[model samples]
Target: MVTGLTLLHTSPAHVPVFDALRDREHPGAVLRHLVYPELLERARAHGPESVAEDLRGLLGDAGGPVLVTCSTLGAVAEALAPALGAPVLRVDRPMAAEAVRTGPRIAVLATVESTLAPTAELLAEEADGRPVSVRTRLVEGAWELFVAGGTARHLAAVAEAVDAVTDADVIVLAQASMAGAAPLARTRVPVLSSPGPGLAAALRLCGADTTAAPPA
Candidate 1:
């Protein structure tokens, strides 16, 4: 039985979101976090393998379920999963699965440039040989705003970007932090976020029931 979770995240700002969900889903289940912005930065600066070695070490040490919370590093998580010797879940995998079901015209929106490629790749992989048209958009200056703690401003920028992508059948928010900002978009099509489904999946992967009542 799974009794703990080890969350791997690129940004510290995302911890609260996952923490709340973990607490709600399974209160007091051992939760450990590995936050390293430099990991993703290294991926961008050098290559995905740049962080694979470090991730392997982390996963080897994680005694419970591990969740990769960064879209940019999700590929590395998948690659190292075979050697992880434990259950590993990607935060965006569920989102990718659902997004591909919507339509072929998928638009992935992100604030960080690094998130785009991996997200689109995940969607394509989820499509499972089906022809899917995936385009990516980076919200101008949204990452800066988010890093500066201007979350509202950052969300507004993301919402605007969503509004601008009218041709897309569905919009996939590439980063977990942007999950909350999706609803702010005035769009006719579905706007998808990873955090909700991802957290649900994580709980399940770790042998916790989504409907299981939390401790009062």
Candidate 2:
């Protein structure tokens, strides 16, 4: 039986994305995916705090080292870690930390408006007193395309937004869904995505050996 990491996501699209990542990074590893689309709807309709009760209930059955793939709920997941009695990780954290270490000027690109604040806040926390500047850009209409199952168009829009940010030392893709846009972005600045780094962290947290995984 293959047992490794458990992922909590607000969208079903993430299932394939992370599944593919695991196949490439940790071949033959098994992953459990728990997607709750309503969680995101409720969070966006209300606020991050409003999802706390629902999240707590949902996470009650989740296994350790659960990776929350929604950027808007990243902070809440981290906050609930202690109470959850399991390792709850936000997908963007590892990417945010890496962005902080990469350069002083960081450009964060997101499709969802709610993702902007959480991502920027996480980046600042990762900076840890370092003199780093973060600029956030929301790709207009990209989320609608993604919701309508237009993956290619959504990626192209995000890539265009990435290319528009000319003053950044590094570009950070705020949402895991935005990872696909990284390679499509035609820019000199390094584009950092969450899945690779987030999966690595999830494996570590779950006590899975990552020696065979490719270098980041």
Candidate 3:
């Protein structure tokens, strides 16, 4: 039986983000975060397939549902899910489904260029025969700020990107790291972030009680 949620992340920065989410929403939920910065670097230097073995190595022992939070590696993880023993999920999928339900026109914003294609494809898949149009925006240079530990500036750039897309019915933050920008964005349309929805999905997949009361 599944005992907790296992989060696979390419950056260590995501640890606190999802940890805080579990604390606030799931309180007692067990969450194990495996962060490997080199995984992303190798994927960027080579290709997504390059990390397939590495991910398979890490996931061989992961308990409960495994959530892959990096958009660049999401597809690879998903492709390996059936053989990985545990339930593996891409973090942005829930958000993508929500975006498709919200409207036909969707805007996918990503700080890194690599994230756009994967996220846009996820949205298209989620459309499930519905007519959906997706627009992608790459917040150029914002990823540099994020890597430099300037989260506030990264979020500012993302928020600006969000405001620039005025024609979309809903804006999707392709990276879980970009979620902070959602609240700061002053856009007319709804902004969707992955972390919350992703965690909820992971909990459900693991058979955890998502509606459980939070710690006081």
Which candidate has the top score in lDDT? 3
Per-residue accuracy of model 2 over 1-216 as CA lDDT, tens digit each: 455678999999999999888877777666899998988888888888989887887776775668899999989878988988888889989999999989999988888888999998999999999999888888999999999999999999999999888888999999999999999989999999999999888888877765465667
Candidate 1 residues 83-151, lDDT tens each? Answer: 767888899999999988999999999988888888988998999999999999888899899889999
- Taking all chains together, each candidate's TM-score versus the true structure is 0.92, 0.95, 0.95
Tell me the spans in candidate 3 whose CA falls farther than 4 Å from its real position. Answer: 212-216
TM-score of 3: 0.95
Please give me the total number of clashing residue pairs in predicted model 1: 0
- Please report, as a residue range, the 10-residue window in candidate 1 with the lowest summed lDDT: 206-215
Q: Would you list the C-alpha lDDT of every candidate in the order shown?
A: 0.85, 0.88, 0.89
Backbone clash numbers for all candidates listed: 0, 0, 0
* Local lDDT at 140 for model 1: 80
TM-score of 2: 0.95
